[model samples]
Target: MTDVRLAERPELPDRLPLPVVDNHCHLDIRRDDAPEVALRQVISEAASVGVDRLVQIGCDIGSARWTAAVVDEHPALLGGVAIHPNEVPRHEAAGDLDDVLDEIASLAQHPRIRVIGETGLDYYRTGPDGVAVQQESFRRHIALAKRLGLALQIHDRDAHDDVLRILVEEGAPERTVLHCYSGDMEMARECVRRGYYLSFAGTVTFRSAKDLRDALSVTPMEHLLVETDAPYLTPTPHRGRANAPYLVPHTVRAMAATLNTSVPQLCQALSDNSEHVYGPWS
Candidate 1:
């Protein structure tokens, strides 16, 4: 959680030598710093620092609608829609799961909707009781991706093993992305071997994320992607502040340092991978 009292947003990073796409973000999220940072402002601020393209995620019903509509208006934004795993229990308990999944399926048909996700398992938040529905939901989302011929973006939390197991069980879509990947070296190797893309977020820049960096070490650049997962995992130096698309350069710089590669080289790779996974922003 960001310290809202620190109303000061960080200054823009020195622009990247090459522009890179923010593979995962939630511009619709309302944080205290700027409850709803104007969409125009979000795009402009990010562009000012070479973060020109953004893949906005709308993981719930309302935001999914917002995403479907908004993506049509912004050439810089491509979108993904899903019912997040943590949100699974609430709908299942209310018996609204079927209805919402129907809605997601319909909304996903929008021309600008390019991905089905921010889905998958998250054991850290939901306990054993919710596991069944979460797994069911994940399977459905994976099926939707394959049926629609769209990419899938996963949100695996403390549920890496189960996540991997289910992904293999369901037969993952061609361009599956483990968004904000937090798995270990061995799991990283396995995921890469299975041809999954691992997207590193601001969390990778943390001092305690040595394992996360190690995972990145083995993830080939072609399978590498960068993201903000914004209004959340704000990178180091800007940790306590509300995150946004503009802060992506910080994470990009950190990733380059960890990979022991030039910033330009990594930026080009991230940019290339984003397009490869989600297709062109245009």
Candidate 2:
């Protein structure tokens, strides 16, 4: 059974005229009791709506392993592996931080793993005490991504300056993405100037996200990406629901509206950007 606290599953939106990619999702964290069944349903439903593929993100050790395996079995998926910022404190305390990161570094070698990410700063939940370890982990992940020649997906939250500083200091990977980009217009321009990709999530569709929409307006289509970050950040009208990849059309449609373009136009741009960052899914 799905969690009762979450909003009910939403009806599917109309199929997109062109295919788009969900640049970030967590298939392993579906609310359904039978995850395998849920995963298949979401993927199939997403395809029917022209969301042809997903970049499954694994921001923890177990999910990283799961993501690595799941992508091998599913033609519609690629993988992103890392330890999340909040998890940094726990792992460091366990005294196996390096070991797990080494394991993640090994997992980066997997053919289906195309990204190292969701691995940047987050000061909102983590305190000042944990910032050093988090920064250390972030730097190492940046290095690992560069070493493996994979795209870097960052999870910046309330630590934008530090995140950008470290990226410049350590030298960001060739392909760097600010996943669920929460920065304002100036920050957006800075990211664009630095040639970093900004991936917007469902939050961008919310009425409360005026700043995000402003950032989107200035972002070039080629540098913009979209994601579900599913089971969280469910887009408007379905804002409180248990999100899935199938629901991406709603967000994409809203994004098109915000950019004052047709859905297909935005879809094509998003598809092109996804492929540019992660290479071909096919």
Candidate 3:
């Protein structure tokens, strides 16, 4: 079940003509509330903003099930399964990963399970001791996604080179995505050149994120996606408030400005990119 605080229903506009997609969120982590109630709240909030589809991430075994359940309830929601880097040690020590991976693999066969991650390196959060475990887990998930022909959603933080090196070396699936891409302009260009999708979040809307804006400006429209990363990184006008999928438009607006395009155009491009990565959820 989702947390009440994270799943509050949002007020949508009366007429929502634009098309949008929340490419990343943790519907499975909604603060300790009933799953049904949380899902209803999320659906209502997203629908209000004309968001036709959402790809919710399950960063662990339990959340993976929750994500699948939510997708079952809300046809517009999709699921991705993997153990987040921070959670790898616990999963390994508990001897719970095999069951988790087996369950996730089985769940990936579902039509709504479109991707196999939100998984990758996070050196900033975990020190050197966690490196081996993180890498082993990352490679395992990558191998699974490759074998299953599923999209791989990566979560890289301050470990761009290692992540890229591993992906390149292992020949990651063609439909890989870098969620909340926080790398420099050069890395962004390299990722685009290598045919990876770059999904931006609310951080793009911050006043001091000139580098990120510059990176967005240079990235091609076909390889770009936008997300809220909700219950976190809320965009302007609601910077301090808890974020939800409904706030995607603010990030979309900021992306459009950065790319020197109209909101409709940006939305169209992002929706197209999303469909390419996760297949058409709608």
Candidate 4:
């Protein structure tokens, strides 16, 4: 097992212990100055909290390759390959987007690279020059995921309609996941009705996330998933610090409360939902 430090100390409850899978994370973004050490720490901390598996996502070619290497080393971790919408312009201009996409496609052939994304639109950050590029890039990623018959993990930030429209228009892969789902109840219901998976991140644990809680309350247990989005959304007590997979249980507890279920039951449902969307846990 790897040795990693906890991003924050989580108070574990005794009665509701359950295995968890962090459906989304950026392991590649950790300190590259000592990647092995950092990764080891991440693994150790996650395992401590019953996080049996983690899907490590990469947003560009370098990050993708790095994440694949991590997956190669750790059997419990899986890799996700894609270019973030914000990075499209730089990649396209460098004439490396195709090469990157090709590499990602080839990487997906690996047993551990189980999903394709962190891909989708970010209209919240789009300028005129970036908007067209983002759309085209998002379309290409969608088409690639569809063609490869792989699970697609989407990141829609303040561009829900466009994101949903493109997915519907392009005939999104049968297995589609909205990572860190930030939509309201209507959108949640629509996603559930369409048989899509919604992954809740640490944001759902925040006291200010009443809308997210409302959405979670209405979402069917079978269609819901939970994640830390680690190295990012760290959940309540750990907020303002770098997030990690071990903190996922906090989000799980929050989701359980929202769903009016026990943590064990919620965790089981999340495990089933994750496996259904992304296949058997690595």
Q: Which candidate leads in TM-score?
A: 1
Better of 2 and 4 by TM-score: 2
Residues forming the 10-long window of minimal summed lDDT in candidate 2? 30-39
lDDT of model number 3: 0.83
Per-residue lDDT of candidate 2, residues 1-282 (tens digit): 455446356788999999999999998885654234467788999999999999999999999999999999999999999999999999999999999999999998999899998899999999999999999999999999999999999999999999999999999988999998999999999999999999999999899999999999999888989999987898988887788888888888888888899888999999999999999987
Q: Model 1 compared with the native: what TM-score?
A: 0.97
| Model 4 lDDT tens row, 1-282 | 322334334454233377778899887665222233367777877787778778899888888888878888987788889988988877877888788778888887777787889899887776668778788888888887787777889999999998889888887888889999999999999998898889999999899999999998888888888887767777886676667677787788878878889888888888777777777754
Q: In each prediction, how many residue pairs overlap at the backbone (N, C-alpha, C within less than 3 A)?
A: 0, 0, 3, 1
Q: Of the candidates numbered 1 and 4, which has the greater TM-score value?
A: 1
Model 2 misses residue 72 by how many Å? 0.7
Worst 10 residues of 1 by lDDT: 1-10
TM-scores, one per candidate? 0.97, 0.96, 0.91, 0.91
- Give the alpha carbon lDDT tens digit for every residue of 191-225 in model 1: 99999999999999999999999999988899999
RMSD per candidate (Å) reads: 1.5, 1.8, 3.3, 4.0
Runs off by more than 4 Å, candidate 3? 1-17, 31-37
C-alpha lDDT score of every prediction, in listed order: 0.92, 0.91, 0.83, 0.81
Name the lDDT value of residue 212 in candidate 2.
95
By lDDT: ranked, best first: 1, 2, 3, 4
Lowest-sum lDDT 10-residue window in model 3: 28-37
